[model samples]
Target: MNAEPPPPAPQWAVPPEGGWTADDLDTLPTLPPHTELIDGSPVFACPQTVFHSRAVSFFSGHLLSSAPPGLEPVARFTIDIDRSNRPEPDVVVVRANAVESLRQTRFPASNVLLAIEVVSNDSVTRDRETKPVKYARAKIPHYWRVENHDGRAVVYVFELEPATGAYTSTGIFHDRMKVSVPFPVDLDLSAIAPRPRAADPQ
Candidate 1:
């Protein structure tokens, strides 16, 4: 008979109470410039490419520029749910007063009204799978995905349904479409797309 496979090796499990403490979080490898600890596992953030960065900048700038009174735009900061689960959404819109308080530390989930992810080729799976589940678990009210490829943006809007711990699809906006939600303003897709630039000569 073949020998038993070492009792099947103990499976790793996420810690109860607090997933990871600050000290344990500090010991993780620091490379690739940006990584987040999700349930004590290191999840690498997608690297900033030109188009990806542009999409983030465009939408962030638009939100900041057009935000109504009391609303503000936040970018690339960890929104801590607990020690083990801190996700740094690409863009977050929260109350202006809350933004001021979060400057001193990680933004609490209560302050987050909307979370946006600008999907890159490398992060599509994590954004669509891991993150949505995490955000849904956290009860974030709204989530948006801005998908870019060959210079176009495809927007997906999801509204969290508290009863089911999932996001119910609200809308899907393609090129040149507008998205209007409960948030203070409407989002025009054209504003988030790449614009024409003068060609470089040889």
Candidate 2:
């Protein structure tokens, strides 16, 4: 007789009372990697694509170089929005002194200068609609949404409106990005990703 198969893995369950807390994100061993907490619920991120990876890298690098000494650029880090929400932005510009430890995983919303989200197919709604509202409400001064358009990057810049507690579109950049707020940011968007070469004629 063939050997019996090993037992199946246990399914992960959430506490029904209030869904997932920010702390549960760190404590849950079985949770998928890059799992984000949104409105007391766990939202999982799909696998990254080449465009997403390249765009994130380009933005992080530019922010790292352009940010002032008091600010630092961090990539793929979670922000402690509140007890229920801890969304990890693709790139964040934060106060250098706000981090308590070298191993700190999350930063308070107040410490963040700018939050960036690079749009992926699976994250369009969250990045375009949901997260922007949350970030604006948290009073994050600046927000940038990067999307791949025909092998190039397009940036949608937003600034928080304090009176309304919402974000207003400051500008939209296609070929290049030049922003004065949230520190001076100037980059050639064309270099965000390596484009495919045209085929040679026979």
Candidate 3:
């Protein structure tokens, strides 16, 4: 059997600074096509597509609205798992009190109660594979995948089992399914379904 091509090197192995350092990442040019440091290597994320943008906005809004008094909903924010990796998840749920502190510096992974990723055409694999492994490895408690395609929405919830470094599938909630997280609330998936727009009449 052909040797499985060596697993792609961790994104952090290459140094944009000639030497990996936080100062190098901070000082790098900040311009269009924002780059995030993952495992010390720079990963460029493209601008969100209309569908991707809408899904993120809708889900984030709902999470925020439903969150209990002590839980905070944050959107498109970076979470720094370590010096080598800082990923910006689509939506994150954290403790209400840690919001200000997380905003002031690199976002803390410890305080993140859940991390959500909305699938974009370009990033489906990275979001589904790379990020899941990374999040599981970091021992983050919950990870959610929101897929928007084929005129439908599908949400998958994975609860992490750190001992195995794997995320056990908890539940898959589709349209109309009520899904519960560890928190006190449950989400109605239909509330976030994508509605097709009417075609202009000829």
TM-score of each: 0.77, 0.91, 0.79
lDDT of each: 0.73, 0.88, 0.75
Residue 110 displacement in candidate 2 (angstroms): 1.0
**Each candidate's root-mean-square deviation in Å?**
7.3, 2.5, 8.5
Q: List, residue by residue over 1-202, the lDDT tens digit for candidate 1.
A: 9876664422233343545543344444433334566776656675587767877787788888877888878787667766678777888887777766533545776777789998877788878998888888778888998897556778888999978979999888776545565454555666665678889997
Off by over 4 Å in 2: 1-11, 195-202
Error of 1 at 36 (Å): 1.5
Q: Best candidate, lDDT-wise? A: 2
Tell me how far the alpha carbon of residue 186 in candidate 2 is from the true structure, in angstroms, after superposition: 1.1
lDDT of 3 by residue, 1-202 (tens): 7777777654445555644543345555542344566666677778777667777887788888888889888887777777777787889898877767533644678888899998888788878899888888777899989887575678888998867878998878776545567564555665565566799999
**lDDT by residue for model 2 (32-117), tens:** 88888999888888888888999989989988888889998999999998898999999999999887899877899899989999
The better candidate by lDDT, 1 or 3, is 3
Q: What TM value does model 2 have?
A: 0.91
